[model samples]
Target: MGVVPTDNELTGTVRSLRTSNSGLGIPKLLATLLSSQPEWSVSEKRLRKVIQRLKSEEETNFHPTSSLNSALDVSKYSNKLKPILFGPEKGKGLVATQDIDAGEVLWREDPFVYAPPWEIYEAQMAGTASWQDETRSNLTKGKGTSNKLGDESPLSKDAIWDTYRSFATLRNDQRWSHTSENDLARSQLENTFRRLHTVLINALYLQHSESQEDVTFDSTNTGSIPAPSRSAAHTKQLKRLLRVPIPEATLNSLFSWDGLMEGLGKMSLNLEAHGGLFPLHSHLNHACRPNVSIRHISPDGSTNSILHSPNPSRITVIAASLIPAGVELVVSYVDPSLDLRSRRRELRAWDFGICQCGRCLEEENSNSNTEHPEISGNRTKIEGGDERDVGQLEDELRGFLSV
Candidate 1:
């Protein structure tokens, strides 16, 4: 051994190596460091100790708990409804604490995490400046484009991690239980991250290319436009960004993939549009003829204004009809106008299985009775036919009911 390297020197070397090559393994890092600094005589065991210490320091510095805790507050809405376990199959649901009148607001909540749909992500990757403006205009006119929930921007790694943390705290889903199944899930998550990473990199490259064109060309020039391509400078900038290390804990936990899936599962069950994961709103179970309706609202309580506003929207739960005390609050997961068979089919696709709501049960009983030929005939037509045929059958059924 020559001379032992100082702790500060060893720490700096390790940090530099990690910054240059984030995926470098410990053995390789040690060998590379020793080779570069032949004057230093550091043992492999000593270098390992320094590496662990640096990781611990980084983890401690990266706490987002304060912001997360502030955003998750539901104290204002706690008195209106309470979570109650119905059974293993239904899991936890919300019940009214007091009688709620029709049109009365029950609760308003912000999303724990928000991600735009694939279309929006593609637009961002393509560097389309007009996509957001068009989407906002459509939403204002009540001609909303997509049913999927999401915010204005493309999904970020930070948002993904936040979603994971929210799900980990909830611990309501059975999928959270760790087993051998996680290996497959982890692989899927890695693929998702890789795709997202590529999208972000490509978007950055395109943005830079556009800026370069603006600088190099004048408006008076009527020359043919050149195709976009990534420059060496853009690649260097992206490489620097990609080298930033992700927290070790986040990589190992559900946030990597399962947490994202859980968030999506909850979104499907709860939200209509304006993608977000509202914790309090999620407890309300599904019913065909539900007593409540959910909608997105701006901070000032304007329903339509949320579409174009830069501020995040909140989900407002309103009583559609009179809900008595001690009753469970529910909302329609799909269009309530759909016939029994159609409704059941939609719910089944959502993994809700057969709906056992009171209206559904009553309809099922009515269908079982041979006395209702019109109702049975309409159901058969809807099951076998397209939307136009179903609409025609519905009109015929309405005529019979009127008589």
Candidate 2:
């Protein structure tokens, strides 16, 4: 007779049954077991059906398509590339579905949100309640914020307290809420009133926009998110659009003393300060040898302008080399022209990962071989015995520092 099952073995079998059945109602479980496990012979199709049923339930109740996933939906972007869970270790990367030629425009993206230096400066100026012309006019009186508050830059704690006081004062004024001028001033002057502070506000606002259906912030009154304006009139209107309300919880989580420090960390890791936050662009992993090069293309038809502008500009990723279908696309995050040591160090420090690309690996091996010539010679000989092999080794040795 087959070994008699112990109580523990029976318990384990029942547990597996319960799991596979997904805690179905007693009546359903009895019927399913009777039909699927007749004579204890469950088929693969029945087990698969159980898994599909469980997954369908999970999808219906527990998991909704997330904002990031929604943003990355391939149909919304190009047909040339697709994002996927690249490999076991690398989380996400873009792969080519079709063979791409050199210099082809693989993708173009506009920043979801960005903060240029000017907006931050304007916010700082308004938060201080010091119109430069007014302050300059009062300079002769020696009683203006330019003199008494000259030491208080927006980054200082004193300036932050001043901003809070100023906001409170403005709120009390009858014109502050409805009057466009006062609304504009208060809009720019709220929060920490620093450039970085304003940028974080924008970043949070975009996140809020993305996840609004799933979660609600305390206040949705954060006025119209700031955008680049070309005229004084446009700037005035942009500043007065609307005020987004900051929930006390959100303030604590993102802008309190510790939260302020954390915002900087987010900026470093998640933001492209000069470039703006391009969710799709940030997904591309780094490599020592890159297949693509990014260029800031003109918002117009031509691709000339490469400098940061007041507004978000279109950025294009061009193929630098012919890439085959299904190949993982990579671009260098750090300057590839730097010496191997410097490039590796920069990648490790800023990117937080050592590149394992072919060039980086070769550099590492060459460095090791140089420190031990005998080992290098033995390996070179082991690789081949003919003159062609010797010539190849010499060429590799000569080109060791080329990258």
- Strongest candidate by TM-score: 1
Q: How well does model 2 score by local distance difference test?
A: 0.54
The true-versus-predicted C-alpha distance at residue 225 of model 2, in Å, is 23
Cα lDDT tens digits for candidate 1, 130-162 = 123335424432345443436422333233333
State in Å the error of residue 336, model 2: 0.7
**Candidate-wise lDDT, in order:** 0.61, 0.54
Steric overlap count per candidate: 2, 10
Error of 1 at 270 (Å): 5.4
lDDT of 2 by residue, 1-403 (tens): 2243444443445456678876686456546654644545443455455545655755554211221345466656678888777443455678899999999987777766654423444444444332232243243333444555666444333344445546545544554456888667767655323443343344333331242232222243344455421446655766777455668998787655455533332332311224366667766767778898877555564544333233334567889999999998887777778756556555545434456688877866876533332112223345355423343365356458552
Cα lDDT of candidate 1 equals: 0.61
Best by lDDT: 1
